[model samples]
Target chain A: MNDKKIKNVFIEGAISSEFIGRSIAKHQTKTSIGAHNIFLGQVRADEVDEKTIYAIEYTAYKDMANAKFHDIREATFKKFDLTCMHIYHSLGTVKVGEICLFVFVSSPRRKQVFKALEYVVEEIKAKVPVYGKEIFEDASHQWKVNS
Target chain B: MNLNIKYFGLLTEVTLCSEETVPFSKATVSELLDLLFEKHPDLKNKDFQVALNNEIVSKDTLITANELALLPPFSGG
Candidate 1:
């Protein structure tokens, strides 16, 4: 695996659709990428104990999370043939119906991008030291555990 | 040894602080946790995993570093 720079994946709050659009538009210059696979994780308004979750306050062990993301990136590069990739996740509060995670993978072929995108997202879910606190409508909160 | 322990997410709520330093003679990660659990009984009821020097470790792993973190379940996308 190449010495891919350890990129910081966290953005301050919810990711805007405009930002995501610009990201895709920026990649058009690389015409070699025949397939582009994108994954966006949206915050859901879930109800528990009659309380509806209003937002998620995300936090992370910054150093460890960055290293884990770097490892996942290298592992993905080794497992799939790809042209380029970009991953962004939200830090702080992201309200329900907002975007929290965005992953984009491009390759010359569609099949490789499909497999690679899922692989990266799943690895991120299982490994990275990121946490989310579900803030309810009444201001009560609960810690979120990945299922 | 003087170890710096960090708490994240639910663990922070239990610890009532984000980070702290505790001095101990324990030789393994589990031993230190046992000491911490004794100090903060609330932590004993919380679910978490321990990481030493930025890497998750098993209970039996020896304390090879001074930086430790108590991490709650991950929920990132």
Candidate 2:
């Protein structure tokens, strides 16, 4: 049960580049980590029915989503030799061309980091109960579903 | 018992309220859903799964007095 808890993943709005840079900087002291893989999810301006998506408003069943993220984190650690993993996602409106999700994974070798990064991102896409409603240029909205 | 129920995402569009405490007798998840459908007819057609205490539960699961949320499909990256 001690391993059941995890760090919070939700950020109020879009994740900034400076924060991400600092996260990477903080890990430099750990000489054991040789390679790091980063995955940044950006909001795309997809055209739907002549309406262009300007922003995505995100919401989640936070308690459950965080728990699922913890499960994913634990599973990823068990499956790979990793130094550390950090995940942060936006909770509110993230505009077009904005970074919404940041996943950082590090390992002692390039191969482990490569494999582990994909596993964590894919697991989050499939399991986390977070919703995004796409707001169009004309102020219309539609719920987004992962393909 | 008065149970607390929460709705998220698209389901909140139908219920209009995110959380509510409603009176309920002991029942299965499916039966509680039926009551919800009666209150918000629009929810009957929405696609979602029931979670009791943060874990997704099947319709046959007995209703318990705890955190309950109706979660719509995820689109998160």
Candidate 3:
């Protein structure tokens, strides 16, 4: 939580399972963490006007998005008793059923991880200056709005 | 004053460009928006907020920074 570096939270494409597994494996050195919670956001193949979504193309105002992510990380640490946390969001094309967002939070106790993980995800959904273009199967697209 | 104006999300589609340097003599965010509306009339109907130097600000806030961004509703996770 004391880490103040402005970590880049963006990945060029979908987050792979192997990358996630590696992240977890690297945390073994920190035996102080008693509980870990994770949240993965997948691209849903939603239908609109009879057309199904095939993928989403993501973009962001990099400077502002990173700043917002940093603020959210700092705020979450202040609000929760978390041992560590990591967040990653996808940029560019992400196919349906692929992972676009990943949040990992660890704490010394079970309850803190549960609360901190949800808080971080909700804050990212509300505050980050990132955009998604939902591309339909017919190659048409529409801007995504978070409900 | 000359300012760096950035368009994001749907705003970029409306403007047909992502970022541009615009010269403005305005003192407030609302006044600056008026100038943009004249150039891109379609933007007047779009739902968005203005960020002055990376912070969301009210329309009446004084223009103190040389950078501004038009941000539509965020859909990030």
Best by lDDT: 3
Per-model TM-score versus the true fold: 0.95, 0.96, 0.97
Q: Give lDDT tens digits, candidate 1, residues A33-111.
A: 9999999999999999889999999999988998888888888988999999888999999999999999999999999
lDDT of 1 by residue, B1-53 (tens): 78899999988888889999999665888889889988899998878899976
**Model 3, position B70: C-alpha lDDT score:** 94
Q: What root-mean-square deviation over C-alphas does model 3 reach?
A: 1.6
DockQ of each: 0.85, 0.85, 0.87
- Could you tell me the lDDT of residue B76 within candidate 2? 98
Q: Candidate 2: TM-score?
A: 0.96
lDDT of 1 at B52: 79
Tens digits of per-residue lDDT for model 2, A35-110:
9999999999999988899999999989889988988899999999999999999989999999999999999899
A-chain TM-score of every model: 0.97, 0.97, 0.97
Residue A102 of model 3, lDDT score: 94
Off by over 4 Å in 2: A1-4
Report, for every candidate in turn, its global Cα lDDT versus the true structure. 0.91, 0.91, 0.93
